[model samples]
Every structure is written in C-alpha cells, then in structure tokens.
Target: MLLDKSVNHDEVLLRTLAGRNFYASIQTVVKQKSDGQLLLYGIIEDISERKHAEQVINELNETLMKRAQELESVNKELEAFSYSVSHDLRAPLRALDGFSRILLDEYQDRLDDKAKDRLSRIRKAAQTMSGLIDDLLQLSRITRVELTVKPVNLSQLATDIIVELQKEASEHQVSCIIQDNVTALGDAKLLRIVLVNLLGNAWKFTRNTDQAVIEFGVRSSETESTTIYYVRDNGAGFDMAYADKLFKAFQRLHSANEFPGTGIGLATVYRIILKHSGRIWAQSEIGQGACFYFTLGK
Candidate 1:
C-alpha cells in the first residue's frame, strides 16, 4: 500500500497476539534512490495511554452532565411544591384575618376588653403569617426568575431604599452614607431587593439609637480580584454565635417583638446572591453594630 501510495498515515486500534488491545499512529514513507531502488519506511507510535485518558475524561464529563441535569430537575420540583403550599396557605390566612376583623367590627359593643384583645391578637398573628407567606413566594420567585445581567448602580439603589424607609418611619432619625458610583454587574431588580432588605434592616434596627449611622460602600481587595460591598450600621446588632443561621428561612437572631420581621429577608438576599454566584456574610456582636459584606462574582 505504501509503494502504491494508497495510504500515507493512519490511526488504528490493534490487538496483539496475546489478545492485549492498544491504539497506534502509523506513518508510511516511500523513497527512490539514485540507484533505482525503492525504499519503504514506516513509523508506528503507541498512543494507547493518551487514547485511554481521553476516553476517561469523556466518560467523566458525561457523568457530570447527568448529575447536573438531575439536580436541576429536583430543584424545580421543590420550587413548585413551595409555591403551591404558600399559595394554599394564603387562603386560610385571609379567611382568618377577615373573620377576626369582622368580629372586631360587629361585636365590639358586646365583647369585653379581653375578648377584643384576643381577637386583635388573632388578627395580628394571621397578618404576620400572611406576610411570611408573601416573603416565601418572593424567595421562590427569586430562585426561578431569569437573571437579566447588566451594570447595576448599587449606590443609587441603596439611596432609593433609604429614602423609602425614611418616608415610612419619619420619626426615626438615621444618618445614611452611601458611596458614589459603587456599581456592579448583576440583575438590577434583584440587586435592588438586596439593598432594600439590607438598608431597611439597618434603618429598622437603628430606630432606638440616639445617633444612628448606616453606611453603604465598596472596597477593593488586594489579594483577590472581586470588589467587596458592605452595609454597616450602628444599631441593635446580633450575637455572632447565631451568625451561621442568618441566611436561613425563618431564622432570626432577634425576636419578632424586638425587631418586627418575617425573617425571610436575609434568606431572600442569600438566594439572590447565590443566583449571581456570589457570597454574603455578616459580622456583629450583641451590643455592637453589624456589618454585612458581599462579593458579586464575575
């Protein structure tokens, strides 16, 4: 075949006489000498190790892809279940709140102080549960929503959220210092939610302080390429022992009586940051202030 110029180079899987399988790369060369004699030369290289390595890598890739698909499917099922349960609970909550309100309105003259207070408590509990359900739905939506990534002005978002918080709690005085031009690449709407919860918590926890100071700023890391954004507040901070539970649903370091919240805000923030492939953490002491730091992944 080499003399006839039928084949120049080829790769083949061959089996030895002992039944051992291997791969080879073969190259053929034909030359004519001045003495009019033809010379045929052939080179064969054993490529079995490289071929085996490639096969193993391909198999591993396939397995990883399958696992990733399975995980995604399970996550979708759990999200659907959460949405259905939350939606179902809202109806009963609404009924409870409505009936309690009706009783308070119609039977106010007939009911005593204790009875009225009990009804009001029932109404309040139901309302709080309803709010929690709403927050759960929002968290679920955050997980499922498609991210529209773009340049987001986080400083502007923090300022806007602070303005809204001030309008709601006009009596509480808070000094907010927002850094200028602190921008990031993320979903603008979702990042806005992050600021809303962080700044709102700062504002809420600082209500009792004589001079409340909340700061939103960014700092560059010398060791890493990511920028660290932070929300710091001189307010009712929390114990560091429970910091690990800060991002879980229904987990609160402070009691509802002390700081009125559904406890899902941080969880929602955590989910949004995870969706952006980022990390969030907090530092605090019992009486000292709290500072939340986060890095958005590139």
Candidate 2:
C-alpha cells in the first residue's frame, strides 16, 4: 500500500477507464521508498439529467417574464389610445356645432325659410352630434372612475328628477309615485343618470299617448335577491326582436323623424349599471308599454 498521489475515491473514478457512472478507475503517481513514478488522475460522474432539468426551469421562467411584460405593454397602449380618442376628437365637433348655431342666429335675414330650416336642421344635427360625443366621453370616463357603494336615496332622487322634468312640460300629465324607504348602496350621480335616462326615455316615448302614465317604484322578482325598481311607461314600445341590440352604442330602433336620439342613452345606462354591479333590462312590445328594471349591488 504505497502511494505518492491523493484523490477523492468516493465515485470510483467514473471518468478514467470507461467513464461509466456506476463503475470507474483512478490513475495516480506512486513511488516506492527507493524510486518515484507518476500517472494521470481523472475522476468524473454523470450529472447530465440534473443539469438538463435546471436549464429547462430557467428557460420557462424567462418565457413567463416576457409574456407578462407584453401584457403590461398592451394595457398601457389601450389607455393611451382611449385618452387620444376622448380628448382630441371632440374639439372639432364643438366648433362645428357652435359655428353653425352662430351663423343661424346672426344671419337670420340672409337665409330664406327653407334655407333657414335646413340650416336649423344642420345645427340641430351638429348639436346632437356634440351631445353624442359628450356621452361617449362620459362613457370612457366611467370605465376609469373608481366606484364606491354609498347610500343612495332612490325615492327622493326620483321625485327630484321628475319635478325637474315636469318643469319643461307644456301639456303632459306625467307623475311619479316613488315608494318610500327605497335607499341602497350605489353611486348617487350615476344612479341619477340611470333614473334620468330611463324616466326621460319613458317621458319622450309616451309623447303620442293622450295621457302619459309613468311610474317608478320597486317590484319583487322571484329570481332576484334584491328589490328591483323599474320605470314603467305607457309609450311607443319597441319590438322584442331589436331588444337585444337596444343597449349597444349607436343603435336606434326608431328613426330620427319618429323618435330622435343619438342612441347612446341605453349604452350609458348599461355602463352605469355595470359599474354599480347591478343589472338592467327592459320589457316591451310594439305600442304596448316598456318597463326598465335595475338594481344596485347589496
């Protein structure tokens, strides 16, 4: 047992002879006490599987990080695009509406009756377009606003809104009976818009009836856990076939001559309801009546 070199013989020198994992050899420089000689030393083991696993894990993490970065970039781009459309596009529409109205008023004598009517129509369309653009801007803003659940007095709100509407009435006998103790958690301003649009639509559509009847109150549904309040009206109700398209942007069931609107009202209502975590739906038939039911989250 004479040796002149030291080696870690734990793995049986797996790289020396045949370089196998289970069996191996070791070379060394050894000399007796009289003479000295030397030999090469080699020791290796198979760790290929473990190294491959580590490489795969590192590659997976890299791919996941890149995917997350891409999603974040997409989100930022959408926000910037919304800002551009809402902020930049409405400036020219305002100018168009303002100038048309100004020309009509200041140059009344310069335009004949038909010409003036056409000009008036143009101004009306422009103003309507402006209103539509404003609604779109509002819709965009609604998406970004943080909503909170606060006490909303639906009864008082309905009464106030209805009284305001009645102020503009000439010969329409439309009244509201807002049930007492109808308060809930919702955005008051947005809820007011919901009331305004729903009730205003009711009032406008019922223009042809000899006596317009509209009501606002809560009604029980077997399916819902919350009290569903609805604005019911005897009006020019639409066909059920178009009901599915009712809440979409720029979708109008009636022509501008019959019932004029920019078709953004229902879309606004839908957005407001969604923001409140509520639901809204309408039931109507041609010339019967329409009812809009909505409820805020509890």
RMSD per prediction, one decimal?
Answer: 4.0, 8.4
Give per-residue CA lDDT, model 2, range 5-109, as digits (tens).
Answer: 555543342343555444433334444455454444554445556556878999999999999999889767867877787788777877777787788889988
Off by over 4 Å in 1: 1-73, 220-224
Lowest lDDT 10-mer window, candidate 2? 7-16
Q: What is the C-alpha lDDT profile of model 1 across 1-298, one tens digit per residue? A: 4453533448898888899988988887777788878887888778899899999999999999999999999998988788787768889988998999999999999999999999999999999988887888889889779999999998888888988998998999988899999999999999998998999898888878889999999966798788999999999999898999999999988888989999999999999999999999999987678999998985
Q: What is the lDDT of candidate 1?
A: 0.89
Q: Which candidate is the best by lDDT?
A: 1
- What TM-score, computed on C-alpha atoms, does each candidate reach? 0.76, 0.72
lDDT of each: 0.89, 0.80
- Residues forming the 10-long window of minimal summed lDDT in candidate 1: 1-10
Q: Report the C-alpha displacement of residue 211, candidate 2, in angstroms.
A: 1.5
Q: Candidate 2, clashing residue pairs?
A: none
What clash count goes with each model? 0, 0
